[model samples]
Every structure is written in C-alpha cells, then in structure tokens.
Target: MSIDAFVIGIFFVTIHLLANELIPADRIKRLRWLSFSGGLAVSYVFVYVLPSLHREQHQLKDYASTFTMESELYFIGLLGLLLFYGIENSVSYAQAKGFAEYHAFFWLQVGFFAFYNMLIAYTVMASEIKGVQAVFYGAAIGLHFIAVAHDLWRKDPDRYRKVGRYVLASGIFVGWGIGTSLQLSSVMQSLIFAFISGAMILNVLKNELPKERDAHFPTFAFAIISYTSVTLALKYFFEW
Candidate 1:
C-alpha cells in the first residue's frame, strides 16, 4: 500500500477511536465545532464528491449495455441516503417511545456505519485521490466521522463505549486490507463512490446542522467558504 493511503487510513481509525476526546461535551463548544465540521463536509461534497459522481456517471454510460444501467449509479446514491435515513428515523422513533435501550437498533446502526467506514477507507486507496488531495479529502471525512461517532455515543453511551466504537474503528483497516489485497473493477469502485457520497451528505447534514438553538451559523458559513476556496485552489492552480 502507498504510504499516503496507509496514513489516511490510520487517520480515520484514530478519529473513530478518539472521537469522545475530539468532541466536547459542552453544548456551545460542541455545536460550534460540529457546525464547522458540517461545513467542511458539505464543501467537500459539492467540490469533490458530486463532480466525481458525475464523472463516474459518464464513465458508466460509456459501458452501458442497457438503458436502465446508464443512470442507475445515481439511484444507488439515493439508496445510500435512504438507507441511512431509515436508520436515523428508526433510532429517533425508538427514543420517542421512551425505550430505555435500543439494543437491536444500536447494533444495526453500528453495523451499517461500519460498512460505511469501510467504503470510506477503501475509496481513499482505490480511487484517483492521492497525495495532497487525499489529505484534504481525509480531513473533511475525518471531521465528519467525529460528528457521526459522537452521535452514536450519545445514543447508547455505555454500549458504544464497550463495543460499538471498536467495531467501527476496525472497519478502516478492514477496508484498507481489501484495497490492498483485492482489485475491484473501475465500475464497481465508481458505484461505491456514488453511494458513499450520498450517505455522507445525509450524515453530515443531520448531525452537524442541528436545530436553531444548537447550530452556529457563522462558524458554519466561514468553514464552507474557507474550505471551498482552498479546495478550488488546489484543484485549479496546483492541479492537485
């Protein structure tokens, strides 16, 4: 494996493992940081993810054997969003019902995120993202993971600490292993990218853009502008 990919993989694993420490407990601090992270994630989605999806769509179209397959990748992206939304909705519903513990739902959510984490790590190595560009991509995603892990921790603190965190953390290496060992076709990798992009949009928006009382708009706006500018500079000027 390339050192850059390995390092980025470790970065994700570290973020997952130390998320409790990374995210503050104080409401205001947490909200502000989460807002900033949300902006970064959103910026990456617009600047990198969506464009990459479109590129993948074009690539897919070149190999289309059937009309349905031409645009099916975007549908897969929607499926990713829907899958995560269903998990989030179910968790909220269980909480509203005064359920003390979401035993089954907890595992289900963690399991899905584990797969999500795998996709994230896998793409880091398998995709065209490399060198400095991977650093930027990894940073945005690392912050996004912090927000997601923190949410899971809030949902089932005891169980998450005991088992959930480690399972999710392990997904990073598992994906890294797969990337290093198995060579997936370009079409398969493109589809994986599309799915993760959609899921990432939902995850970032849902957790970081909290209710009015919990959000910090100024911080969010600043982060969005700053990250977008930097990313564009890298892509256009430096050709990263």
Candidate 2:
C-alpha cells in the first residue's frame, strides 16, 4: 500500500479507538465541543461532499442501464438518510418504552456504524484522494466520529467500553484491507459517496441540533465559518 493511504487508514482506526476519550465528560463542555465538531463536519459536507456528487453524477451516467438517470444517486442519498433516521427513531422508541435496557437497539446502532466506518475508510483508499483533500476529509470525518462515539458512549458506557468501540475500530482497518485489495468501479464508488453524504448530513445535524439549552450556537457558527473559509481557499487558490 502507498504510504499516504496506509497512514490515513491508521488515522481512521485511531479516531475510532480514541474518540470517546477525546470528548469532554462535563455536559456543557461536551455539548460545546460537539457543536464545534458538528460545524466542521457540516462545512465539509456542503463544501466537498455535495460538489462531489455533482461530479460523480456525470460518471453515473455511464452506468445508466441500472440507475436510468444520474439523479438517481440523490434518491440513493435519501435512502441513506432514511436508513439512519429509522435506526435512530427506533432506538429512541425502544428506550422510551423501557425495553429491558435496549441492548438490541444499542447493538443495532453499533453494527450499522461499524459498517459505516468501513465505508468511510474504504473510500479513503479506493478514491485515491491525497494531499490536502485527504487531510480535510480525514479531519472532518474524524471529528464527526468523535461526536457519534460520544453519543454511543452515553447510551451504555460499560457496554460501549467493553465491546462497541473495538468493533468500530476494526471496521476501519477491514475497510482499508478491502479497498487496497480490490478496486471498485467508478459508478459504485459514486453511489457509496452519495450514501455517505446523506448519512453524514443526518448524523451531524442530529448531534448538533440538540435542545436549545444544550447547544452552543456561537461555537458552532465559528467553526462553520472558519472551516468553510479554509476549504474554499484551498479549492480556489491551491485547487485542492
């Protein structure tokens, strides 16, 4: 494997392993940082992910037999959003009803996100994105993972520490392995990218848009403006 890709793979794994510890345990401090990270993720999504879909849509046209239209990727994106939303809603409902601590729901979330992490890592390798672009991708997703990990940790601290984290970390490396060993078609990659974009949007907003008392809008807005400026500068001046 190339050194850059290998390093990126390791970086992703490290994020999963260390994410829970990285966020503050104090509620106010935790929510503030969550707001910051959520902004970073949202900025990256709007600046990079949506545009990526437009570019990849052109390539999707080549595989039109199955998709019929390049815009179908948007439909796929919607499905991605709904899938995570359904999971989140179900978990909430289960918790409300007091379903025996909701172990099943917890595992359902962990399992989905493990595969989600795998896909994130897979795209890192398979897309062959490097240099500044890779750094931003890693940073945004890494911070985003921190937010998600914090949520999972809150759900069942003991269980997450015992089992959930390792599963998610392993998924990163497994995806790296698959990506390095086998390259997928451009169309397939585009489809995955679309799905991830939608999923990412939901995850970030869900985490960020907490009850007004729990949110820190100023911190979130600062992060969004700062990260957005950096990305836009890179795209226009350095053409990253």
Candidate 3:
C-alpha cells in the first residue's frame, strides 16, 4: 500500500506537469475532455465522499469541545465551496480591470491553489485504496486540474506559464512527501476529504457549466452522461 501510494504520487505529479504542457487550445477539445473529468469528479463526491463523511462522524467526537454536529464535515465542505467561489470571482474582477493594481491577487490565486494541490496530493497519496482505484482517482483529478490550469492561464498567460504552474506542480510532490510521513487520525482525514469534495464541486462546475466562451454543450452533455453512468455502474454492480 505504501509503495503504491508513493509510486502513484510520482505519477500524479507527472500528469499535473503534463497537463500544463499537453492540453490543446481548441474549445471543443477542452470541453470534450474536461466534461468527463468534471463528471467523474462530481460523481466521486456524491457516491463516495458524501457517504464516507457521513459515516466518519464518530471519529470527530474528539472535536466536540470545538463544535457539536453530526455533519460538521458537510459544514466545512460548504465553507470550501464558498471560499473558492469568492476567490474565482475576485480573480475575474481583478483580471477584468487589467490586473494592474491587483497583480498581487493573481499571486493570491496561485497561493490558494498551491495549497489546494497539496491538499489533493496529500489526500490521493494517503488514500486507503491502492492500485487501480488510486490511479483512477489521481488521473481523474489530473484532468480536472487541467481545467484549473487552463483557467489560470486564460486569466494570465505569462504568469501561469512562468510561475503559477510551477507552484501548483510543486505542491503535488511536497504534499506527497508530507503525506507519506504523516499518521493523521481519522478525524483529520475526514476533514481533509470534506474540504476537497466541496472544492471539487465548485471548481468543476464553475468551469464546466459556463455556456459562454464557446462552451461545447453537446460534448459536455455526452461526457456527463457517459461518465456518470459508468461511475454508477462501478459503484453499484462492480462494487468499485
């Protein structure tokens, strides 16, 4: 299990780096590929993450002194959703204004996503499921990350190519290094998964559901329908 995680971590980093370089510039192509990515991500959250979080509440009783709730993780997930939505809007506002006074805000986006990457990398590496299950997750996440990287590049080309990609790419290795060494309790793991699940929802939808900017509706719909069907099949029948 440990070796699998470490190896998968390396593969995750490679794919993230490749996403910055390899994804194409066509609108249709982007949507066709990313729709599946977004659907898979969202499906994982609904079918796996939500149920796991609900089942993990007992692990968080030690946190009762801090708060009391059967669904605190869900609450945390909501915060994660709001946080990214706010940042996404703020960054868009700054970019529309020519990013003059607010170039620092672009860096803020980088900083926020660096932590996001680290969180995701840590989660992927720390997962109890190894082999193909972990690889499936990491690759699906890599495709979603490609959308995020595109958004960043679209917002600021020079900076993303020069700096932002490097930051997020580095986060994977850093997170993996940290995760492999840490022995977090179940509560900590639950909180991390909750936050990622929420962030994934916001990030994928924001990019995928936009109808403007030549969004490919046909491809998007197909990807969503196909990927969701496959994911549900695996969950219910194959027991994956």
Give candidate 1's TM-score: 0.93
Top lDDT model: 1
Q: Tell me each candidate's RMSD, in Å, in order.
A: 1.8, 1.8, 2.8
Summarize candidate 1's per-residue lDDT along 82-150 as a digit string, tens digits.
999999888788777877666787788999999999998888877646778888888888888888888
Per-residue lDDT of model 2, residues 181-211, tens digit only: 9989877888888898788878877764455
Could you tell me every candidate's TM-score relative to the true structure?
A: 0.93, 0.93, 0.85
Backbone clashes under 3 angstroms, per model: 0, 0, 0
Per-residue accuracy of model 3 over 1-240 as CA lDDT, tens digit each: 377787777776665555556765544465456555555656656666667667666678778886587778888888888988888788789878776767788888888898888998888767656766666666667667777787787777888778778888898888887788886876788888888778878886677554446455566566667766766776687576
For each candidate in the order shown, give its overall lDDT on alpha carbons: 0.83, 0.81, 0.73
lDDT computed for candidate 3: 0.73
Model 3 segments more than 4 A misplaced: 26-28, 58-67, 210-218, 237-240
Off by over 4 Å in 2: none
